[model samples]
Target: MSAPVRADALATLTAWRPADPGQRALREAFLGFLAARPDSCARSCEPGHLTASALVLDATGDQVLLTLHPRVGAWLQLGGHCESTDATLAGAALREATEESGIEGLTIDPVPLHVDVHPITCSLGVPTRHFDVRFLVRAPAGARETRSEESLDLRWWPLDAPPDHELDDLLAAAQIAR
Candidate 1:
């Protein structure tokens, strides 16, 4: 595992310009958490861990690719826990997006579009929080996707007609409109 991932995370957060007061607060909390736990990027960190996620859009940015998460039973953006091999948060998010969507050649925005702290019983089978750093990803034109075992379903939803969920706030924050 690269120890630089933690440093990369701290740098990413420190350089990030939060979109709102809530985002600003989360960014501060994330910085504090990283300062305290050197292993915060690993899933085994117990109380919580840093996670990377990507919200994938088509080349034209008119459509989004989402997965029906088996764990959450809801269609959500593609992303998950950072791996030992990941060197940066943006890389981790892109890696998860690729692994889960089976789509290669995706372009990622290094800056995070959102930060969220949510509690769940992850693969560890224990309750923990996910300090998710979400990035925006753009797929190549005519991009084809295959569903990986990590998801129950995978498909593209038009931005104008997204699934009923929290993607609304995400879109709003990213300033993406139909």
Candidate 2:
């Protein structure tokens, strides 16, 4: 990623103060990650890397778009690892949302909606942690979604009552976004 993109991510994280103890710990950890590696956001970063993701809401904000991730086999919001072309974490989230959702003109809330650190076994058999910075993205009215190759299926789900076990963080992020 470019210097400006790195700077943007740093700036955003620096300004964020999480409301809860768990989130506060995540913020500190993310800051540490940024300090430890300038290319922390890059997918190639060994051991762990940063990722950008979104809780994508429909135009009315009553529904959310989710993808059944092929690898994880779970319904998740659109997102992925940062790309060299991304100029900001928000940009990365937006790009991932647009690409995965196959929808254009999606508007993203600049402030981060959530932060999480999770372990994953990559395709190459390497274990890594994804320090995910999450944002809230709003889709345009009458938007139609197409499934990307990364997903087994893509669908819109009611925001008021999401699947309890699978989307606890997403539901919490929705509350934070609102």
Per lDDT, the best of the predicted structures is 1
Q: lDDT for model 1, on a 0 to 1 scale?
A: 0.89
What candidate 1 gets wrong by more than 4 Å, as runs, is none
Candidate 2 lDDT for residue 4: 68
Off by over 4 Å in 2: none
- Computed on alpha carbons, the lDDT of every model, listed in order, comes to 0.89, 0.86
Q: After superposition, how far is residue 98 of candidate 1 from its true place, in Å?
A: 0.8
lDDT of 1 by residue, 22-108 (tens): 889999999999999988999998899999999999998888999999998888899999888999999999999999988889999
TM-score against truth, every candidate = 0.95, 0.94
Clashes of each: 0, 0
